[model samples]
Target: MKYNLIFGGIRNQDGYEENTEEVLRSFLSEEMEIPNVGDIQFQNVHRLGERSDGKERSIIARFTRFSDHERVIRAAASKLKNKPQFSIYQQYPREINERRKKLIPRMKEFKRQRRHAKLVYDKLLVYGEVYNPDAHREPPPTIPGQPLPNNDGDY
Candidate 1:
């Protein structure tokens, strides 16, 4: 089934990075190829118009379909071990175009910088560490399955 995934958040200093993008692209490529799957194209990624007080950037990712979206979000949530605030919504091609219209200026700047850096340095600093698909093996299922208390004292 076709699925759309939308996620946005304030990025850390190093987020929206080339390496991060590569990792995500590779993961998505692999994940979307399983049996009973549809295309998993990356639709859009953008930096929010406004910046935070800490000078951090906000980024958004829009996937082509819902199942694809879910798979990516599940992978992310697993990696972070938290419920993701990322969202999903079905959109017509027109709606997607409208969204990208609003996001273009910010995205254009990044693209421009990338081009400039390539001309100047011959290469840009990008995420380089390779990822092993099975690197983070799931812990064994506990027989009693005792859940731990929240150590953050939020309770």
Candidate 2:
């Protein structure tokens, strides 16, 4: 329940197998300035998937206390704000993950088109344009015997 996901932190590929947790702990303490990292108990620190093309895999760190997780994340938001190569994210449900995955390509497309793009929850904002998949709906049909309202504001 208390966990954070880290992306693009590790760089070296040679000694990663032996230093995965150490690297993460160091990052949390040094870079993120997370207090009491050593004192805080962690459930695990592991890669999300197999390494490919010498790229480091994303890390999943589970902590024993939710406060520790929140502390790390809050520190990371300020510490890593200007650093684009590293990111810290809170764990979410599978449905949210699926929705994020669906929006990834659209975000990329916005970038490709040289427009600013940001995903806020389930909505996609591109160059100040908002796209909400669930917001679109057809208007209700009018009754056959009822007269349509005047559009010229004559009343």
Candidate 3:
């Protein structure tokens, strides 16, 4: 899959407001020997505040191509004068595809459980015979203080 090692400089010049497009153009416009780096773009921009020179602004560039970690890094390195604090990464398309492949069975299992739980809940909500048991009238209660007959209600 195509991946980009995106990075660029923060120009510390007076009123230079780090134009990301310019830096990226400088990188992509070059004739690169590496086969990877098909196109380049600025992914993000930042203001790193004033440096010793004056206003400091950062430019983040993305080099798009299909290559491994080492190749992309090497390609980016060739374009820069100083060492870059970069993060190695893969393309989103590749990562998403891999995750989808892994999630198929788990998603099926989750759907199955949801259906089963819904069935049980529906049955409970229906108020079946077991939920409403047969109702009968209660017998009259005997008074405790009443006098008892010979073979009758003695306490």
Best by TM-score: 2
What tens digits encode model 3's per-residue C-alpha lDDT throughout 112-140? 66632111211211122212112323434
Of 1 and 3, which scores higher on lDDT? 1
Q: What would the TM-scores of all predictions be?
A: 0.32, 0.61, 0.27
Q: How far is candidate 1 from the true structure (C-alpha RMSD, Å)?
A: 20.8
Q: Please give the distance, in angstroms, between residue 71's alpha carbon in candidate 2 and its true position after superposition.
A: 0.3
Model 2: residues >4 Å from true position, as ranges? 1-4, 12-16, 51-54, 103-132, 137-155
Q: What is the lDDT of residue 121 in candidate 1?
A: 16
**lDDT per residue, candidate 1, 15-115, as tens digits?**
54544344445434443233333355656655546555655344445666656666665665444345254332333366555655544454455467773
Each model's lDDT: 0.45, 0.73, 0.41
Candidate 3 residue-wise lDDT at 19: 58
Question: What is the alpha-carbon lDDT for the whole of candidate 1?
Answer: 0.45
List pairs with backbone clashes in candidate 2.
none
Off by over 4 Å in 1: 1-39, 82-155
Question: lDDT: which is higher, 1 or 2?
Answer: 2
Which 10 consecutive residues of model 3 have the lowest summed lDDT? Answer: 117-126
Considering summed lDDT, which 10 consecutive residues are worst modelled in model 2? 146-155
On a 0 to 100 scale, what is the lDDT of residue 3 in model 2? 65
Tell me the alpha-carbon RMSD of every candidate: 20.8, 8.1, 21.6
